[model samples]
Target: MSDNFSRPQHTAPLTPILQLVNSAPIVLVAFFAIGLSWWFLLIGVIFLVVGGFGYWASWQRRFFWLNEEGELEARSGILFRRSRQLRISRLQSVDILRPPVARLLGYSSLKIEVAGSGDSRVILSYLSVGKAQELRSEILALAKDERTSTQSAEPADHWKWQVPNGRLVASLVLTTSTYFLIIGAVASVAFALVEPGSGLVTLALAVGGSTISLIAGITSLFNFSVGRNDRGIAISHGLFTTAHYTVSPIRIQAICVVQPIAWRPFGWYQVAINVAGADQSSKKSGPRVLIPVVHEDALPELFHELLPSWNLEIEDEWLASAATSRWRFPWQAARLAVSLTSDLFVVRSGALTRRLSAAPHERIQSIRITQGPWERKLGISSLHADSVPGPVRLRGRGLASSVAVHTALAELDRMFTARKSRKSEQW
Candidate 1:
């Protein structure tokens, strides 16, 4: 675990121009929109150039190196002089992003995400695309204990599946956009009905925000794809602003497959995952997407390929035997199901937003069994596989026979104990 290698301290040599290129579109839009005088415009140009130079100067002082303890050490900032270190073992994912300008310049940005809250990580921008990929693979290989002091020119490639362009567009357009559009229409109507004078302004804001959301959703899914190689499952997508995300199987804490009510007719489902110490930090599902739009039949195959440990075959049998307690909420229980395997537990629920969530035995930070007054009478319990804080909780409610409930809980506890022992021994 001890290796020390350092890069010469400097920004990407072309970062200054890259900054200018990044801001060009915004600058041009503002220039024409405001119609400033020639002198004022010239001053603006000078200010931007100076700012870019300052940013490049700051990056020049930044140095990134691997320390003896296998942590990434970053020394940055000009006036502030900030230093940070991220342990290689705690690293979650390495994402590569390429905005159009960066791609045009043959450069890419590396985003290093670790296991925790907040945006505490490293970012090396405007490196050659090849260099970024090399760095990503090299760092990821460390966690698997497969890397050496010597280097390889390219990361190993094992291509899996690329989302079809048609499917991506259909998925985005059919779901969130439609919801936003309906809300915009209703809100606009309500505003007009409530206050005539302010109606136009409110309507304009509602429609505008919805339109922007729709556009952003569509843009985010552009060129979306997923693959697997030696290190782990890799995802790459985006049109104007491209990004690549990779996660090792061991770090995949949970996975969810969702099918919107509208998408059910089409048999389309969107898959999302929660990694050990990472969050998309976006309100939208853009950051967690495993598959944007996939048919029901295709999901098992994809899950098998990307996550072989998660077996979904148990789903059919589980659904048949799913709790049929008449006391269970009629609306929610019918659509709910759960499946179990030696390594993973899957929970399927949701009415309008049908969800199938799964988590590995070791990832279960805690397990809880709860019984309501009605459920206690019915002799049923709700089982929760609790992990780190996330937007969704994975659980199966009103499953029959307290015996079955206790059995599952005991099994989870045993698995959790065994996994912890194995990890402690490895360390």
Candidate 2:
């Protein structure tokens, strides 16, 4: 294995074949459809031939390398001819993914994300496991403006939090989805008992959906753990498709701690964070999940590990919703509050599932205040502290108009001061 990726390098030669194998489900379905009609066989063959050719062409065309300017550059596409270059300084996170087939074949994929890219990402797929790891390390080192050294052993990571398998299983079982699944199964069984064929479809649907959901949850969170090293925070998880992510602390825009009503009794809380460049639209538990499940007592230590500079303690001077907001929030008006700490802006909301969202002053991209016609009549407004896209939403809803305006201005001042100080600090 050579450390020099300065020259454009093609991925593993087996990439095309592996891609075809990965699409086996679609091929299987096409074969199954052909059984219904002899004429369908022609369509299936054409699809297979076309898809195979496309995969081969894609593999042949795609190439990636580290450019002289210390940027990651990738080129792909057979006909369109696409090229992408990402600056090392803008790199947000690096991830390595090993799907079932790739894992079995000793291959992995490297994903590099940059700030403000939305859903767009640079993916180098089907590289040998060792090569991918080496490439990842090189990229990370380059991103940090450090010299890459092959002789130096990788820095050891301090394991901070690990989710026990039993706890994760318990957490999955206690979810609202699981409860609904159980109810659906019972109803389907009862209906079938009354009329054998009446609930057959319902039973299958309920069982299928629940099975898929359960498997996805298990696969995503299996062996979940978090660690910190000199470079950044590391998150590794997944069963069928293992994923390792290295997230820079400075890339974190906001964080939220959530506690479902059911989880409250057990003192369990889920932590999620907003990171620039990561896809927030992913349905599966992805990079946004800081910690899947943590005890209430562990939150303080966990927060410190993630963002040691920012003081995340909830302040006592929380401004609750205005009296007129009772008409809108009803039972939750009292619980809805927004507070500003010395270094962070916090929003507390939710009746059933309590959410505490906090954004550091330096990460606050913008502050917004809105008053709808109905809100104006109620003499209330809402303030939103916008950050990069993610689950952590810092919003103060149903606040007195005057308070909302005052808070917005105060937050803006804090953000300017924080940004000035932050500029002096190095990553």
State each candidate's clash count: 1, 0
Candidate number with greatest TM-score: 2
lDDT of 2 by residue, 183-231 (tens): 7788888998999977877777877887778778888889999988767
| Regions of candidate 1 where Cα sits further than 4 Å from its true position | 1-7, 20-35, 45-49, 64-73, 83-91, 113-120, 137-153, 183-207, 279-287, 315-330, 339-341, 369-382, 398-427
Backbone clash pairs for candidate 2 read none
The Cα error of candidate 1 at residue 296, in Å, is: 3.0
Candidate 1 lDDT, 228-260, residue by residue in tens: 876667787888788676666676678887888
Model 2's TM-score against the true structure: 0.82
C-alpha RMSD values across all candidates? 5.1, 4.3
